[model samples]
Target: MRAFPAVAGNETLRNGLPGGLYSLLSHAEQYRLLCRRPDLIAPAVDELLRFWPPVVEFRRTATRDVVLAGKEIRGGDKVVVYHASANRDESVFPDPDRLDITRAPNDHVSFGFGAHFCVGARLARIQMSALIGRVVAELPGLELASDAPPKRLVSNFQNGLKELRIRWG
Candidate 1:
């Protein structure tokens, strides 16, 4: 139907799929950090979304004048919500910078909130869960192959890893 554009689906597959993979890899990395406590794997996924979300910024338009964190914006204002900043907000997440796998009540906004939430959120989580579970189950000794850090793309919209050099057990 012309109501829904073909380009939207194409972009979703191209971007969403990779974003899920990125979240999964980050979960794998967290396993290394909390190897002693293997039980932390599940929450690590949420932690990754909070620590390093798939995208940096999203856009929205305010329909009514309101104050967000004491800042007032009039109606019909275009807003650029930064996920990276909100995820690490100290007021909301204590010890925000420190990654805690056992963190409970993780109200992360990686998959937007309210009316603008992603429709494929559940599917994406399932994919990440399966991939992360598989990697942890099959490759227990996997490690980063290179000492050099991952090369992140210089983009304002998408948060992606240009290359993730790793070694399989």
Candidate 2:
């Protein structure tokens, strides 16, 4: 880890691609992605979860009468926790509006918290990371294919870009 600082400080190495995987080696690399290096897999899935979280709103019913944030709730009353809102909570994240690649300790509740956590979380993370890694590697110099701006979805629940056209050599 100590070597990381010295390597990071070198400007020439900073901008260059390290040759672990290239677009040409994809067939073999892809097979390994399916079977090995699960550690790499988790972050990839987390990235997509950060990008497009599913199960937008989760509702929980109070076992008994309760009050939270000065709001009164009776037993069997359903309270919704909007994951999308919580994921972008400004109090928790600096510049919550931006997508940061290196944000650590990102305890976003996209997958729910505590006992309610998703069972497929591990699998989900692996698949997403592998998929994204492959796409980026294939399109190393990828860029927007169209000059036109994107058209966003009208629904509040979906955070998808309608179109993101791109082409690269």
Measured against the true structure, the TM-scores of the candidates, in listed sequence, are: 0.80, 0.62
Please give the distance, in angstroms, between residue 151's alpha carbon in candidate 1 and its true position after superposition: 1.5
Q: lDDT of model 1 at residue 128?
A: 57
Model number with the top TM-score: 1
Number of residue pairs clashing in candidate 1, backbone atoms closer than 3 angstroms, sequence gap of 3 or more or interchain: 0
Candidate 2: 10-residue stretch with minimal lDDT: 11-20
Give candidate 2's root-mean-square deviation (CA, Å): 15.0
**Cand. 2 TM to true fold:** 0.62
Estimate, for each residue in 23-141, the C-alpha lDDT of model 1 and write its tens digit: 54445655665455556656766776677777778888899999987999889999999988989888889898876767887888877899878777676666655665666667777
RMSD of each: 3.5, 15.0
lDDT scores for all predictions? 0.68, 0.51
Question: Where in model 1 is the C-alpha error above 4 Å?
Answer: 1-29, 33-40
TM-score, candidate 1, is 0.80
